[model samples]
Target chain A: MFRNIFVLFAASLFCFASCKKTTPLEFQPGDKGELEVEFDNVIGGVNLQLNTGSYTNASGETFKVSLLNYYISNIKLQNADGTTYTVPRDSSYFLIKEENPSQLITLRDIPAGNYTGISFVLGVDSLKSTAPVAERTGALDPAAAGAGMYWSWNSGYIFLKMEGPSDVATSGDKKFRYHIGGFGGFSTPMFNNIKQISLTAPGTSMAEVRKGKAEAPHIHIMADASKVMNGPMNISIATNTTVMVSPFSVNIANNYVSMFSIDHIHND
Target chain B: MINKKKSIRARLGITIAVIVALVSLGVACTKTSRQERKPMPLVLPSNFPAPIYNLSSNPITVEGFELGRKLFYDTKLSRDGTISCGSCHIQGSAFTHHGHDVSHGIEDRLGVRNSPPIMNLAWSQFFFWDGGVFNLDLQPIAPIENPVEMDEHIPNVIEKLKSDAQYPGLFYKAFGEGDITSSKMLMALSQFMLQCVSAESKYDKVVRKEGAVFSAEEQLGFDVFKAKCASCHSSDLFTDNKFHNNGLVPSMVNDSGRYRITLDPKDFYLFKTPSLRNIMKTAPYMHDGRFLNIDAVLDHYDHGVQVNSTLDTSLNKNGVVGIKLTVADRANLKAFLNTLTDDSFIRNPQLAEQ
Candidate 1:
């Protein structure tokens, strides 16, 4: 009877050790990790080369991009288990330039989990856009980070700027310029072109963010430049050479709203 | 050995005394400089309403105001170093471009709108004719970057200041020792602008019961103004700070005034109701400077009002397009308007570029 009891005790101890080893460690309440989102600018599946790459839009007008810059702000990550993690407002604004060496946005101190989707605003929010000059720093500084991207006359940020030469453009220099921005209005209501973008990672590519990992998960996103002129409303360069601070800019904003998509995710 | 030790001790004592004297001298210099930078008081006029600008964010100081005055007069703010803010906003003309219908800027480039005065701006809620710029801090950027105005980028202006021999030191004295940011520069400009209080006018004295009573003609004009014009120009500041359509025939540009900012059809042909504080000095009048004098403006109100969909109801009362002012009423109104000029404000040497 004693031998049988000892044997049962040893068997129970083995089972406990094996069970602990097999189950994955669940993230604790205060556990945190990092995430990176890369915005890859492309024109119809071809990498965008500034000032040299020639591309034709749906209107059959060929154009060469000289400058492209846009604001991405208010980032929020959707956890796989129905929870959302919002980046702090102060550190959320970012300026994505096509000529910049890095378009990767790294979010630190994110709650460690399996993120299934990401969402962000394509332009500065109306509140921050109208914030006091002291409150506007970093990416929103009208003179520094937002020099060319700001409209000093209108007192708002240019949300997206795309300027280049188009053969069919009607302008004297044959340049198609689209400087789109409007945060409603300060005293009265006007054009609000702030677009919200939400992209979900494709099948089998969930961004797994775990603590103590050697590398953080990277969400690769493709921002198609062709969609700016071709999606929803087909913007012909010959017809609309310069669209800025007008009712027509709303259509351009609407087209660019559908420009982003999740290409893949790497959880290395 | 005793004599050598005494000599060494004597030398050490002398060295310590010299160091103490130098340190005190340095402290004295810094103290005087700091005293010179003492914050200037923004004295609010007894007759004026509470200032619309929040002074706590950017406090006024003697150093800051002086720096701003220098920047206001500095030609480096323009593209070709020819036009300063004072070029268009002349102090003798009550900080307006006197006589000119539309102020000319760098390279003799003409702007679309008239150059407004720079008095009592702390009481103003909006900056430009269309009220596009809401904050005073953001107002300078428009003219500094306007193609027909200064035609220079703010960043480039800052760089020029940085490379200057005196501006960097002046900026340091005004806003501590740091990089001269655009925010600091704008705040300094606002400090000077806020100090431009125009409350010493004859109208203000009469209202304040300061013993300076208005003449009989001025009193009659004041009564007429109260009856006909006080609805729009409705405050101690002589402006309700609201947009309205005064029914002037739209210019050839058909400038859709406030509509450009709001993009609302109801706001078409609407412009800010300008303050009447320096009306006697700040002419040609109206947004485009169409009226050459107060009489022309009165004539426009009396018989020259054009009918428009967005015309102010006060101007078009029951299909009557104009205010129907008699010749005598017009003379008295002009007298009352002249009482709004604050002579001391225009001549304040502190506001002039040194």
Candidate 2:
């Protein structure tokens, strides 16, 4: 039954995708309705593979992972119509890897329209963050989103967290963690990071991701692999290779990368 | 004359029709104004009408409630401290500060509000007498951070708990993860609080019509209570959970009850209707702990209500406002109120400090 439902869903999604554009492109198009976004991770030009690692925690010892999945909400693409095609508040947006389809998510019925740029909040909106728990479920349910991100004991979510092998950690062995969330209190902005990008509208006036564009889709996403690490450069050198592995960070707060910003193209 | 009479009749008919239409429109508008209250789940008893604090986001969790209970009693949760929630809210006095009106904490600092007896808490939409704290999980933070209370931050509390010999194991059993977190801690406290269900009381037994009968004195008190107080302090649950000017001198120092929460003048001197289930044990009554016993309380209520507009209507059924009680009647009323003392829930060792 599950497989049948999956197949049916996949077929419908294909129809939804095809109906939006005349031809298929390597990447999705602007406001491609219900497009399955496969987050195939890469560093520079090579694939990024991560694995579980063991280290001591406050509890003495445990095996954790090199990467963890979380949810991001309030997604929007700035369209030339001056409309924001926000991911419907009722729908979901998750950061599940392509390799983990069972765990990954597919956002459906995304409002079809032309969009200049895409933006999203990195964590669940604050109002929903502090809400109560009703049921308990397994590893990959929306119920688990709260389990992964929320801290009931304190009454907020860990809006941003990056923990991994780091030489610059308080301890010599290379695992460091920074959980940034204080609900935007006097000093803490609930979380440490907010990522934004700028881009030109993808279509003429019609709304849809088109076929065979010479350029990549103008979904302005800003990420700096360099911002996450703090250690001797790629100590493992394989999992950490290609991905920047530096000791400090340079995010938009420290530096900015204007995605699809025309200034990078015409001035030269 | 015939034409004038016809015109008058026509005008009357039009006025009634317009009034009917307006009333229907008003009802529709008012009904739609509030957000759609979610339908109660099957777990909600058939007889119960609807829940007040709509559980829209905070869904009920069987596991989370259990987790909250484990954390409630575990002293390993405190930092540099030998205290757990059970240290203060003991079972005997109905989950209140045992033998004391004010709560004592790590290093012996005193908390302000009389440790209100906890019971039938799920029925209540608000916590604390002042009704300042809206959420139950948020309740622990007041004590944990108050310099006189536990005086611990959530992160430190979790850190301390994570290292404790038994806590990580307990946490893993409750939550899948061995890592203890503040959110997890709050969930666990809620579990214990929900478990502290006082549904099997004599009152409950009576209300459920389960062959429980009242003594003559108790019956008389119940009658007087119903006649005078039950309108505001509605039965089934001992309170309507509404704030009222129960009529004490506004405390010289304390916040003006619900007014402190809303800062509205209309709510001045209003306080949450104190649940009377274990009122006999949780003494030093009133928000500021002004009255010492039921005598003082009844006497105060008998003749003590501040004659302000916000004084709840039940107290002034005849529109003759002000606490009204004859001395003999006061004694009878107190005699009746005493029947609400619940012994089983009070003495349940499972809810005690380990």
Candidate 3:
């Protein structure tokens, strides 16, 4: 009789255990680490000093970057052991600008291990890009990011906004604004733009990305602005000066895809 | 007389019961602590279709609607603080600019087209005479940026709203954020516009069998309307929500209408079919407000249709031009159209500036 009660109690406990929600895999206390991701904007392998006029592109059109900002999201760190740790979506995305290069974008609570490579998506994912304005919070929030990056006419974030004055511009103001955003569709050119970049650590078999260490590893990424309009797909500021939203904008977006490159990593 | 085993079983059962109670209590506490907003239901007449605007994304609340109403009336939205949305859309004239054929903006800047009435907008999938904006949340950007209208940038508007003493608190109450945004501001405006439904007309009561009847001439006019006008202006909302040329002539101006958006030659001269519900009050009709009254509008349909490559086939009556109507038919049609004016909607105290 006692055995019967014990078996029933065990069965109830089993049911309770099975019914509990399965928690997502995340960094344990021992595995917690921090990474400082840096974006260095440049022009022709030189530091891009904003508001400094007269930088010539491959097309020979001289221009100055008045404003430059882009979104980076969906970061993943691949370990040497063939396992990958993805940053949580709620806090992974970041909007970087040339003006605030000092504002370090740090990823905390990353799984600590020897990482072979780092991978991330250049633009905001379609799920987030197409989400209604009210759902956006934190870094993705329109108010937080500033309204300049968003096109109030179209319901999508400008994945990349590079505005400046170009000498070749025929317009009265001699200004050129390249606002690129649209996902991949025949009609909707700005919907499915997911540019995945994977880069391996150099000068070592694998970089030791450790947790609870006094010093965290840093990843420096360089974004070349001159390559944006002149990279394999050559765009002229004289003709295609302004691109807001159209199939033409997609051409500019395709060219900028080749702009990001892993510069170097700093080990402490 | 009971065995010791029975007491042990009772205790075990009580312990299990306590655990279950504790688990449920934890869940209840978490749910309450989150303070999930209770959905504010949008009540509509039984006959109306589901709203095109996705209410789930930006749900309406009492505070949001009130904020929108305040913003709609405030001239601070304009660059010069002289023109408000209410300036062009007066509630007395079914929310349309009554005297102006075409709307005038800031600094007495005249717009190219007339301002349409603002009602039954929840059902509409597109907005503006050219159907430029699809989402209601994004519609306000057009007038705000149109150099002739508000002449204000969105960022400038946000900065202005931030500095205002009362707007920050109002925004906090409506959106749970002390910080103001263009999206939140636009969403609040959309909330107020979504509630402007007109359904209490005398014609509506007659249709619902509520002991009301149309006059003999009005009934005749309604029948004539069923045969002649119901194709484009269908449904109780009185709009097909599709673009049509409608044979508006002297098509000299470079207003390519729907063609401007699509860049298709076939879509040229196509304009959105406006709702004829409040036809009597919102006058100087047509996309350009060329017609002064219903008589001029009917006369255009009768004899003034200019044959164009992009003219809608529905208006083509055996290639003879407009819908041929007799003098009596026009009179009866005018009388029937009058019955559609809902005083309850035009004079709704809820929509008035508070």
Candidate 4:
């Protein structure tokens, strides 16, 4: 009886189907991507200028930037191939300031491949501005070391406010403080767009990056802070710096900040 | 022999059919259960636009909504566990701070902006009165992380939620993971907040013709509102979500309402017109909560409007006071605004208490 039962089971098994193929995950893991961004706070491409920024004519006060701080979120490094590596929404970006160069942003877990270029916003878009309280390191620090681009009263970020001082304002010289916000539609505050750059022979692979593929790929951005007051007001307000309280940046003229370059990411 | 073979084959066929049917039924039951376990069984009014917050990226589950409510009431959500969202946004007072113009938070901390009422917010395009914060999902972070409010960091709040055993279970039920994070925290809070729709108000019933009718005073006030304030504060949704410089110039500091956020000169003194669903309950109108009551707000619009270039075009009347109403008309409009107060919404057991 036992032999018969075994024989029957064996015969059934032979009649049954073969093994099913193992499936792969919807999200496949790829090689790692490395990136480096550099920034040059310079004056007319001559001096490696720091501690200088522009002012807005909203208050007509000249405020030479003593500090510059901003955020760059949703970073992406595009490979030469069709495939692109995007910085995850939850992590892999920075809110960097000029004061802290040692703690630059480095994105990992990227779909590592041969990459040519990178792109990122100078400030968080309005959508991300809604939840600006996500905590991380470096740019995520509440202390905001090296970055002076946040408003103390409003608690909102100055996405592209370049302030230092201007000789144009009336009532003697005044401190130019341009607070730029507005990420949500027309009235939101959180937008500063920097140009995008593509790195050449830029290998994101840790091994290739270590083996000297290219100067750690970074985009260079130069914002001339001196041009903050080159235009009309962004909002209605008193011209005197000591006079206006909640003034806003309205227009951009010769005094507006510029991206300068698109491909050369400033790493330092 | 033929009959025997036929019965054997028939039995095998019946067995296979039963097994397949049972298996499929199990899967179907599970799929139905999953559907039932969704966050909320509601959506915004049809007239509204697409929600700024995407639900797919951060899905809402019934568990998530419950957890959010628990967190909302829990004192632990605050820095010192002494103050919670309920401290300022009390259901009894219609979610706005009743006594103070500006909100008082942790350690008797004072917020610069008035603690605006929180209700029917799923339809709101902007969060703050100035429309600074865009999405509803991001609104809690302002209160939770503000130095004068919760005085806590996102990391610290996540840590606190992670340590709490109750929260872990609640979180697992809601999000399928016990490891608490700020995103999860924010998502959960949003689920709870979004479901805070005040559609069951008497005003809503009247609109639906559900045997609800306005009194003579309310009817007169309604007529007045349509005649005078209907341009900016439009039909159905109270506000058209447009901003206006209602001719208010602060004697103290020149605060350029929406202009502060956009840096645009045209939007000065313009604010996100607040929903008047519970306007009667939400006192101290405007961004700074300067006015004491709805009566004062009416008075401002009636006799005190100052004309300027950036003023809301809806209110301008060629140097004439925009939408001037008699003292009687103002009182009647105030009554109509009062009718918008949803007592049931404020007293709903599903939304209130710990």
Q: Quantify all predictions' global Cα lDDT against the true fold.
A: 0.89, 0.54, 0.78, 0.61
**Tens digits of lDDT, candidate 2, A84-183:** 7666765644644323544323445555544445565554555554344332212212223333344433344444444455443444455554443433
Instruction: Put down candidate 1 lDDT per residue, A1-268, tens digits, no spaces.
Output: 9997787677656544544423223455578888999999999979999999999999888999998899999999998668999999998999999989989988888888778899999999999998888777888888777888988867899999999999899999999999999998888888899999999988746787778778888999999988889988999999999999898999999999999999999888
Which portions of model 2 show Cα errors greater than 4 Å? A1-75, A81-83, A88-130, A133-268, B1-67, B316-319
State each candidate's clash count.
0, 30, 7, 47
**How well does candidate 3 score on lDDT at residue B209?**
79
Chain B TM-score of every predicted model: 0.91, 0.78, 0.88, 0.84
Runs in model 4 lying further than 4 Å from the true structure: A1-193, A197-268, B1-38, B43-59
Candidate 2 residues B120-192, lDDT tens each?
A: 6656667777665546755676566556766666667767777778777566555553456666676667656
By summed lDDT, the worst window of 10 consecutive residues in model 1 chain B runs over B29-38
Instruction: Give the Å error, residue B146, model 4.
Output: 2.3
Tens digit of per-residue lDDT, candidate 4, span B69-166: 88888888788889888788878778878767888889897766778777766567676767766556556766776789988766677778778778
**What value does the interface RMSD of model 1 take?**
1.0
**Model 1 CA deviation exceeding 4 Å by range:** A1-33, A208-216, B1-37
Best by lDDT: 1
Per-residue lDDT over B99-185 for candidate 3, one digit per residue giving the tens place of the 0 to 100 score:
788899999998888898889888997788877666777778777877788888767888988999999878877787346887899
Native contact fraction per model: 0.64, 0.02, 0.22, 0.09
RMSD of each: 5.9, 22.3, 12.4, 15.4
Better candidate by lDDT, 3 or 4 = 3
Where in model 3 is the C-alpha error above 4 Å?
Answer: A1-30, A74-86, A101-104, A114-126, A138-144, A184-209, B1-40, B56-59, B153-165, B168-184, B245-253, B256-269, B299-311, B316-326
lDDT of 2 at A35: 28
